[model samples]
Target: CWLQQALRATDNPVIDAAVRLGNVLGLPVLVYHGVREDYPYASDRLHHFILGASRDLAAGCRARGLACVQHVDRSGHRERGLVYRLGADAAALVLEDQPTFVARWQTERVAERIEIPVYAVNGACLVPPAVLGEGIGGRSGFLRRHEPGRAAWTVADDESTDIAPYDGTLPFVPDTLEGDLDALIAELDIDHSLPASAAFPAGRAAAETRLMRLIQDVLPGYATTRNDATRREGASGLSPYLHFGVLGPREVMRAVEKAAVGARHSIKFADELLGWREWFHYQARALAKPEQYDRVAGWARATLADHAGDPRSHLESLTAMLRGETRDESWNACQRQFLRFGWMHNNLRMYWGKRIIAMTPDPETAWATACYLNDRLSLDGRDPATYGNIAAMFGGSPGDTDRPVYGRLATRSDGSTRSRDGGAAWLAKAAS
Candidate 1:
C-alpha cells in the first residue's frame, strides 16, 4: 500500500483495503510512505507534523503485523520516482484516493505513468464517494443520498491478514525515523522559519488526546460555545489530525456518538464534523480542480469583477498579512492562530476571509491571498473544507445589498466573538 495522506494504521480504509487485498492474493502487504521537499508549502510546520505522524504510522503498522517503509526527501536522501519504482516490485498498487491539493495531483500523475494496474480507495470520507453513486447534482440531492448511508459507514473496517508483513524490498533504502525528527527536518530544503505547532502535537497519541477533548470538553457545550471564539474549549482541535489522516472521521464520529453530551450538542457537533465537512469533500470530488479560483460561484465572480476597481484603504502587504502584522486587529488575531498554532477558529475565519476582499487590490488577489495564507500557514489548509469555506466567504448567497469592493458578495464581522465577555481582550492578546 502506498499512502499519500491517510497516515493512520487502523481504522484507515486505505490500509484496510490493502490488507484485504494482500490476504486474498496470499501475499504479505508492504506499505510505503514518502515525503518530498518539493510538495506545496513544504515547511518546518508541515514537515514536523507529517514526519512525526509517519513515525507513529510505522510503529502502528508494525503493531498490526505490517511492514511500513518511509523515505524523507532531502539533500542526501533524494530518490526519484520512488512510487513508480516500488510499484514495479509489487503484485499491484493500492493508494489513497485524495481529491484535493498536492496528494490528488501526485496520485493522478502516478496512475498515468505507472504500468501496474492501480486501485484507489477513499480514505478520507465516512461514506466513500463511489458508494454514494453517480448523478447527484447539488447538496440537497447529495444529502438525500448521503444522510441515509452514514449509519452503515460508522462501523470500523479493521481487516486482518493471515500473511506476514513483506520483508523483501528491492527499491532504495528507507529512512529510519526512530530518533531526532526535528534534527532530520532541520536539514531539509524546506522553509525552516514556520515552526511546528505547540498547540497540536503530532502522532497517534496527540490525536487520541484531541478526541478525548472533543468528547469530554468540547462536545458538552458545543452548540452554545461553538461560535464564541473566546474560549479555548469551544472548538475541537481535531482538524489538523483529521487533515493529515492521523484520525479518520469514522473513529472521530464513533467517539462523538458515545459522548455524554446533550442531544442538541451532539447533533450540532455532528453537523459540523460529519455533515458539513463530508459535504465539502463530496463537492470537491465533483469539481475538476477544486483549488482553482474558477471553482468559486460564477455569480460571486461576476459581482466581484464589477466592483474590482473599488478604492480600498489600509492595504496590507503579503508579508504583513503572512506575519500577522496586518492593520486589521481582528484579522491579525485570526492569522496569528494559523501562524502560531497552525489553526484558526471557524468563527474568526469568516471575518478574516471576508475582510481580505477590502484588504487586497482586487477580488482575485483576495482569493489568492486567502488560499495562500491558508495553504501555507494553517494545518487544515489545502483541504476540501478549507477551500469550500473560503469559497463560501467570497461568494455566499448573493446579498440584496450592493456594497463597495464586496459588491453582491456577503461581508462579515467579528461581532460573534468581539461582542462577548472578554472577547476584545482575547482578540488583542491573540493579535499580540
Candidate 2:
C-alpha cells in the first residue's frame, strides 16, 4: 500500500482495502509513505506536520499488526525510484485517489508506469467521488447524490491482516522515524523560514484532542457562532488534520453523531463538513486541471479579463502580501493567521480572497497571489476546498452594477468581521 496524504491507521479505506486484498491473496500488505524535499512549499511547517503524522502512522500500523515504512528524501538519504523499487515485489498496489495537487499527479504517473494492478481508493472523502459519478454541475446537485449515500459510507470496516507483515524488500533500507524526527527534518533541503505550527501540533493524539474540542466546545453553538471570527473557539479548527487525513470525515462524523449537542448545530456542522467540503472534492475530480486559473467560472474570467488593464491604486507587492504587511488591516489579519498558525478562519478567508483582486496587478495575478499565499503559508492549502472557496469568492452572483477592477463579479467587505462587537479590536490585534 502506497500512502501519500492519508496518514491515519484506522478508518483509512486505502489501508483497509489493501489489507483485504492482501488477505485474499494470503500476502502481507507493505505500507510505504515518503516525504520529498522538492514539493512546493516544503517548509518546516508542512514537513514537521507530515513527519509527525507519519511517525504516529508507523506506530499505529505496528499496533494493528501491519508493517509500515517511511523515507525522508534529504541529502545522503536520497533513494531513487523508491516507489517503483517497492512495486517490483508487490502483487498489487493500492494508492490514494486524490484529485488535486502532488498526490493526484504522482498517483497517475505511478499507475501508468507500473505493471501490477494499482487500486486507487478514495480515503479523502466520506463518500467516494467516483460513486457520485461525473459532471456534477453544482453543490446542490452534488448534495442530492451525496446526502442519500452518507449513512451507508459513514461506517468504517477496518480490515485486519491475515498474514504476517511484509519483510521481503529488495529496495533501499527505510529510515526509522521514531528516532529523532526533528533532527531528521533539520537535515532536509526545505524552507526553514516557515516554522512549524505550534497551535495545531501534529500526530493522532493532537488530532483526537481537536476532535474532542469540536464536540465539547465548538459544536454546542456551531450554527450561530461558526461565522464569527472574533471567538477563538468559534471554528472547529480541524482543517489541518482533515487535509492530511489524520482524521477522516467518517471518524469525525461518527463522533459528531454521538456528541451531546443540539440537532441543529450538528446538522449545520455536517453541512459544512460533508455538504460543502465533499462538493468541492467532487467538482475538482471532474475538471482537467482544478488548480489552474482557467477552471474558474467562464463569465467571471471573461469579466475579470475585460477589466484587466483598469487602473488600480490598492496594489501591494508580493513580499508585503507574503509577510502580511499589506495596507488592508483586515486582510492582514487573515493573512497573519496563515503566517503564524498555518490556518485561517473560514469567514476571514472569504474576505481575504475577494480583496486580493483589488490588491494585485490583475485578475490572473490576483488568482495566482491568492493561491501562492494560501498554498505556501496554510496547512490546508493545495486542497480542492481551498481553491473552491477562493473561486466562490472570485465568482459569485453578478452585482447590479459593474465595478472598477472587478467587473460584474460581486465584491466582499471586511464588515462581516469588522462590524461585530469588539471586532475592530480583534482585527487590530490579529494584524499586529
Candidate 3:
C-alpha cells in the first residue's frame, strides 16, 4: 500500500501513547515521511528506491511512481482517505517489530491508516527463514538445519531471478534526488564526537571492487592471518557491504566456494563465516530466553549485578583494551586494528567480547558498550547478527570459561591456564 506516515492522522492521545510504546519497545519505526532530503542516487544520478526502505537500497522513491502526499514534520496530522484518492495500482508498507511490545500497536495503527496490503519486511537476516523454511523451531534447531546448507549460497546471475528482462516498461529513475553527500550528512546531525571510519566509498561499483578484493587477495590468507589484526587487510572487509545488502550473502558464498582450491583451511574459514554470520540469525530467532531484551540469561544478571557497584577495575581494563593498551599483545593488536580499521577479525571479536564481559563489573554494560561502539563506528552497524554475537559472549563457553577473572562471575571453577599466543604478539607489533 502507499506508505506515507505523515499524511495519516491519528488521535493526538493515541499518537502520544504510540510514541511512548515505541520508546518502551526500542523499535525504530520506519514510516515513509515525504521524500528524503538530499537522498542518495545511483552512480549515474538516478534515484530508484527510497533510502531506508530496506537494506542495501541506495536511492529514493521521489522519482518513482510513488507520490509524496505528506511531509514528516512537527505537525503530525493528515488524512489518508484523501491521499489514497491520489491513487496507485497497489501499495506496500514496511515496518519493524523490535525491542518492545509497543511496536505491535503502531503496526496496527499504520495498517488501519493505509487500507492497502502492508508487507512487514523482516529486514535483518541475510536469507529470511520464512523463505527458506516454515519457521524452523528455534536457535539450536535452526542452526542444525542451516549448517548443512552453507554451500548452497548461489547468485541469481543467469536471469533466473533477474527482474531486468521482464517488462518493456523502463523502471522509474529519480534524477532530482541526486544529493550533496556533505549536505545530507550535516542534515542528519550524526555524532561528530566519534570520527567517521575510513571512506569506504558507497556505490555498486565500489561494492564490486571490495568483493573481488576479498575473494582474491584477502580470503586465501584468512584462515592463517585473520587474528593478527596488525595486518588489517588480511581479513575480508566484506562485513559492511554484506550488512548493508550492497553485497548479498549468497553471492559471497558462491564466489568463495568457486575460488576455494579444496584447502581445508579455506573451507574452515568459510564455515566460521557462515556459522558466525548466517547461522547467527537462526540463533537470534530461535533462542527464546536470549531473544527477550529484558530477560538476562541464567546466573548472568545476579553474577554481574553483584559487582556492578565496583566498576573501576573493569573500567580500567576496558579503557586499556579499547585504547590498544592491554597487557596481552594479541588483544592489543586487535584493539589497534579496531582503532585504525573500525573492525577486527571474527576470532578477535569473540576474544574481545569475552574479555569485556570478564573485565566489566556488569555483563549488561559490557554488552551495551560493545554494541555502542559496533553501531557507532563500524560500517556494519545496527545489525541483529552483531548484537546476537555480543549476546553469545555475555554467556561464556569452553573458550572463555576460566575465571576468578572477575570474582563470582567466573563460569569455570577449576581454572587452568590455556595460553593464547598468536594474537597478542601480532597485535603488539601492530599497536607499537
Best by lDDT: 2
- Show the colliding residue pairs in model 1: none
| Residue 33, model 2, lDDT | 97
lDDT of 3 by residue, 77-168 (tens): 22333323322323334444221122333455666776654544333333554445756644566667776654443333210111111122
Looking at model 1, residue 136 earns an lDDT score of 84
Error of 3 at 6 (Å): 23
CA-lDDT, candidates in order: 0.90, 0.92, 0.46
* TM-scores for all predictions: 0.98, 0.99, 0.63
Which residue pairs in candidate 3 collide?
Answer: 1-91, 1-92, 2-91, 25-100, 138-286, 139-286, 329-424, 330-423, 330-424, 333-427
Weakest 10 consecutive residues, lDDT, candidate 1?
A: 161-170
Q: Clashing residue pairs in candidate 2, if any?
A: none
Clashes of each: 0, 0, 10
**RMSD in Å for candidate 2, one decimal?**
0.9
Q: Compute the lDDT of residue 418 as modeled in candidate 3.
A: 21
